[model samples]
Target: MTLLRPQIDPQIFSALTPRDDFRAIARWVEPRSSVLDLGCGDGSLLALLGNELEVRGFGIEIDEKGVLACVQKGVNVIQQDLERGLRLFEDQSFDYAILSQTLQTIHRTTAILSETVRVARECIISFPNFGYWRHRLAVMQGYMPVSESLPYQWHNTPNVRVLTIHDFDAHAHAAGIQIIDRVILHKGRVIDWGQNWRGSLAVYRVKRYR
Candidate 1:
């Protein structure tokens, strides 16, 4: 698929341009496919996809402000918590399901993953890598790392868990989810070598093992 840079509205997004994770996620989605975005913040990714690929997209967000932002952007969105699972969507209702940069904060990881795959042919997920060198060094020093990807103090953070590239790969294997494609990123650039130790973020495209 040809990836086009998304034209972002400054009013809808804090950043004037699409983030690297968004671009990476967009690359995997085919044009005009149906998409369900879980934990979609401000509907930025949906809007981007709409503009670039003309995808039929719907967003699920819990925050009132985020729901309002999606409306303002003319994107279809619903206000709902992801922990409850995707009961509203039927089997394979969408071509793709996207959970970008929000997996760590969820309490029911396995349930959500199952629901995501059940409701779509494939799912794309992105999250901060807990095994990056900086995070490891901080843990070694007896502190949680604070960086652009993870910018919260331990007490105030919403993250319920942390995992690495290997951690996720193992989890996917155990859960019978097939990881079809993966990309490791640091500072918006793809890392081709030493991904577990060097990359700060990870993205995966997956589907049911069967």
Candidate 2:
């Protein structure tokens, strides 16, 4: 299998740029692992992982422009709607399956997540935190919050179901999965306390329980 080899100079790899959440996700991945990226917009994260960790990456994207961009980046990508599920892929086909900033937008959350877990040994997911203090404050003020992570008006947003870290934890438990690692991010910084209340984004590395 072709895998990306980590650069000899760690500094060079550190200097390689990525979105904050993407960087967090990349760090959780082991070097030279196979990855399946769902809703990989423009193949940015996949390309970054391939270059930084020597991960063999495959991406699934629905948008034509995004698919074109992935091709230009030399990233292997298949065009497919995530809501339809991952029936095309077989069981345990990859080391990690990732869904970043796209969970809320998918209507079939449970189904897609199940497929992700089935297709890979581990699954990594990242999404906006609806329980953030700002969102609460906005609700208190009788309006939806507008922030960097959630940059859309209520009616115009693509996100159908925004959830919190606590919500996700409960969902995972109900789905018979275990969260191996969790990270909460607020304005690009890692926050320890009151993650459900203060965190703007939540990330998790998970696996199905035996």
Candidate 3:
């Protein structure tokens, strides 16, 4: 069964300019394909994909405000805890699944990632790199790192799992997930050198190894 693409206003489209990482994620998604967004906050990414790529998109958000915002943007959204898994969707239900910047916050990281790959032929995952030079420097000084990508304080932070590019690479290898492509970013610009130590954010397109 196919889903209808939401009809968003042109003004809204102009207002909701896709972030740099969101643009990167959009580049990986095929036009007119189906997408499932995990932990979609405010549905901006879904909206952008729907409008620009003409993709049929659905979003899962746990926050009430986020759900409301999605509704306002004419986005299809479900409000549910991500830890419960993506059982609602059948195997390969979407062409792409996105978990942007929410991987570290999820407790059942492995399970969620597995479910994501199960429900989608491909998945896009992005997270803040804990091994960035600044983050390491902060840790060496005996304080938790706080920057634009990781803006939350240690007490109020939602990031439970700290991971770097190397860590994710190892985990993906062990989990039998093939990394099709990867982009490392620092301040929205793609970093080409010393990604593990210099990049502040990591984006990957992956699929379950057959």
Candidate 4:
């Protein structure tokens, strides 16, 4: 039996059961390009992008373990706090900058997203939908939603600012960022247009407008 290393794309080791944590990310990114992953946890997605997509990627993570994981994968990674902002990087330094699932954890999406557009020509953002029917139902039932996508209890949840799919679109407009494309995923399936609000989660591609 081979021991699984965190450096490798989790897929390289069969013993590890792969989950959808990185699914929306891979689907939104191009196969061959430069990418920067903000809030890169454990460097799993960067490894997948490099190995499977053949993309040169950089990962910025605050975790020591995650930084080490990227290094072991032969990926360029930086240890930095996103909330402090990206002053070191120049404008449009990368083809794409990804902020997956991390949107809710940051203090300010407005400023963070501005940095994303400034640092990269394009950006990919995916987040949990706070306005999901189930979430609403939980309020009615007097209990927070505990579904698979959002599995944690209210008190222990890591999410700070859960924005709905519609809320994101509005922010994009306010930021003057153009949506390159957007898609919603529900139960591991892609939903067509006009139904994203009703869907569970969503990923979007955005570009800074002139």
Q: Best lDDT goes to which candidate?
A: 3
Q: Is candidate 1 or candidate 3 better by TM-score?
A: 3
C-alpha TM-scores of all predictions: 0.91, 0.90, 0.94, 0.86
Q: Which consecutive 10 residues in model 3 have the weakest lDDT in total?
A: 1-10
lDDT of 1 by residue, 120-155 (tens): 999999999999999999999999999888889999
Name model 2 segments beyond 4 Å from true.
Answer: 1-17
Candidates 1 and 2 compared: the better one by lDDT is 1
Report the C-alpha lDDT of model 2 over 82-186, residue by residue, as the tens digit.
888888889899999999998998888888888888899999999999999989899999998888889999989988988988899989966667899999998
lDDT of each: 0.87, 0.85, 0.88, 0.77
The numbered model that scores best in TM-score is: 3
How many residue pairs collide in each prediction?
0, 1, 0, 0
Tens digits of per-residue lDDT, candidate 3, 1-210, equal: 222335565677667866667978998999999999999998899989988899989999888898877877878888899999888899999999999999999998888888888899999999999999999999999999999778899999988979999999999966668899999998889999999999999999999888
Which one wins by lDDT: 2 or 4?
A: 2
Better of 2 and 3 by lDDT: 3
Residue 147 alpha-carbon offset, candidate 4, angstroms: 2.2
Rank candidates by TM-score, best first: 3, 1, 2, 4
> lDDT, candidate 2, residue 176?
61
